[model samples]
Target: MDLHQLTIHQARDLLRKKEISSVELTKAVLARIESVENRVKAVVTLSAERALEDAGKADKALASGENGYLRGIPCLIKDNMCTRGLRTTCSSKMLENFIPPYNATVVEKLEARGMVLLGKTNMDEFAMGSSTENSAFFPTHNPWDIERVPGGSSGGSAAAVAADEAIYTLGSDTGGSIRQPAGFCNVVGLKPTYGRVSRFGLVAFASSLDQIGPLTKDVRDCALVLNAIAGYDPRDSTSVDCPVPDYTQALVPDLKGLRLGVPKEYFVEGMQTEIRDSIHAAIKKLEELGAEIDWDVSLPSTRFALSVYYIIAPSEASANLARYDGVKYGFSYENASSIWDALEKTRQFGFGPEVKRRIMLGTYALSAGYYDAYYLKAQKVRTLIRREFDEAFKKYDALITPTSPTVPFKIGEKADDPMQMYLSDVCTLPVNIAGIPGLSVPAGLPGGLPAGMQILGKHFSEETLLRIGYAYEQATEWHRQKPPLN
Candidate 1:
């Protein structure tokens, strides 16, 4: 068997038995990346030297009878995340050459656990788009179909795992960045509650909505990565103080008598027939597993989640991205007559079209004349969305929906139509607005493309989410299918 294709749990077991050293496992993943990354463009930067160095240390520690669960496992970090001395371009011309001086809190925690850093993966510029097409550099091609996208802004990370370039990867989800890409790439992805993972070194998009999580081949690996990264950090005031649970220990597949809520608003008109049919089939499978499906529960605010997310996310983005002016940092214009002109010219030339549009819209919303009308109204709507999820969770163990309204579209299908592109995230935006935990697991491929089934739980209910996903994965062979990379 290819060692790179093994799950994190399996790799760790082999490492503990001295069947494989961390260095050997890291080399297997690196070799896979060398063979496939050029065609897929899944990795933007490769860190072979550092990865082997880290793996050597992990091997030494193990030989001395010291071990950690993730010690020596190869993993990729999304380019949006800052890694000291590594080029962390959130796939934008603005930060194309910028390197951070410190590691993100999550990076620090992962390193402390001995996970090997494979490389950085591509993403949408400032993580603003639903498709990887918005990346300023290059769009990551889906491993399953080279003609289609891998989804975004976490597309590269998903493609990397699906292509067997890495055992797992970390991704940030503001709206559906993690779940949508996972769905498209046929992997497991989790978006933890807001503040569940510290955001100290993440380049900001929407402060309130943005969250960091994991994408992997299965639920067990997802839980392993989450256990290392989720915790409070004093660097971020918004970080929550909840105790981290033993997520990996809760992978029970039996959902006997568990209440599963099916929201009515999610299955409305405009949804693609293939995706809708796939979700209905998944619901029936859950019912067969002893899960009771409830049909009347609804999230009335679901209809407004996309609108509210657009306004609030961009509004916060405008303020956060203000630091990128020519004077302070990143891709400044050379030899301008005046400082003001330099700042203006730098921003105009550095940011991509989609990024510039969001920055302008956010600036207008927060401007003196429209703050109360646009920004405040969005917040009020956000509260309604959160309350709806809270009420539904009171009676249901989890909620089910299609991760995206359709399978991955052609690379440029909706590139010119911003509204049509935004609609792709309609089923996913509500989870971010509500700050609850959500998981996207591969349902099956319909029409020759992959579709994902989203499982949502109440705040801090990641344990339940994994248990449900693992059960479904055990029952179906969908996730076992590989992309035809050769």
Candidate 2:
């Protein structure tokens, strides 16, 4: 059997039936990683020994009749997530050698479900940039075209899955980190509601907007992974105390009368012509598959979403990153004569340019005179954005939009211009601000690069988002296309 091509669900079923051992599947993925990782640069650290050990244990447990949805499945986690004894770098030199004493909540949950940890994938340092170029270590290349970047800061996770280096991978989305990269890589990525997945161990970029989610080859695989990771945690104050739904079971819902709202604002003048056409084609396909498409509705607040996200995310980032000063943990410079000088030099050397830029921007935004004008006003705008989504959800089952404005760009194409890079996330930032669930499923490749259609649902309505994506994916062949790596 070609273990490398099996979805998490398929691999799990095979494991349960004794058709294949978890060790075999894990080894197959490790071998693939060894073959393509040099050119793709997807993985920062490979946990081959640990993954085989875990898979062996999982195989033994299954032999003894223990089972779960993700049992014995091999997967990767974004470097930002803490894994006990494993280097969780967050793609920064600051924590290059830092190993957490405990596993993150999501890590513990996935491990409990018997999922094998393959390794930690690379990402933007502190999850600060749109392209993986900001990673202190290295930039992840798109599997479809090595010259292009797999959209980031979760680029490595998306690229790894797209390149078939792993079964699936986890990513954190602050502003389109998960969905955008998934689009660029031609995979299924979902950003659950802000508090749907606990953020306890996720390295904070923006407290209110950050969310941990999955990047998989298929919608069903995404559901299986989501089932394992979604839940409330008391350790994270922002985690909602809402009930977790059976996401896998939700994938089979009937779409006959489902109302899918397509906001006119998403298909504006700035969007690439091909992306607009591709999204419309996907909508037509969904309509043919029994979903009702609602046309051209206004989402005025969405226009302001990008600006608001920049202000809020950076502002929170400045505060959250304050602890990294040469004090307690992470990288520190001891050569400086004074402690303050040491702290400054450590941060200066540790953080990348994009991170430092945001830190400065955020610090200024939240400073004494600018707080009410910038941060407070942005918060008010956020409420307006949320209200717009709430009003739309009241009339529709979900909102459909282009996951990104254009297909994946060449590496270093937008890396030099930060504002241009920020605009890449225009369509996705609104959902983050609204604190709603959004799913990005491969629509098709236009101009040879992958494009995805974004589906947004009401707060904590991940079940609805997954159901819609599943139904759409079932009728499309785009997700089956593999990037040429041979």
Q: Estimate each model's TM-score.
A: 0.98, 0.99
lDDT of 2 by residue, 306-379 (tens): 88999999999999999898677799997998988998999999898999999999999999999999999999
lDDT of 1 by residue, 1-486 (tens): 899898899999999999999999999999999899888898888899999999999998889998878888999999988999989989999999988999999999998988799889999889989888888899999998988989988999999999999989999999999999999999999999888999999999999989999999998899999999999999999999989998988888878979999998998688889999999999889888889999777888899998899999999999999899966668999978898989899999999999999999999999998998999999999999999899899999999999998889898999999999999899889999999999999998997789999999998999999999999998898888889987
Instruction: Give the alpha-carbon lDDT of every model.
Output: 0.92, 0.91
User: Candidate 2 — worst ten consecutive residues by lDDT sum?
Assistant: 245-254
Candidate 2, number of clashes = 0
Q: RMSD for each model, in Å, please? A: 1.0, 1.0
Model 1 weakest 10-residue run by lDDT: 326-335
Model 2 TM-score, 2 decimals: 0.99
Q: Pairs clashing in candidate 1?
A: none
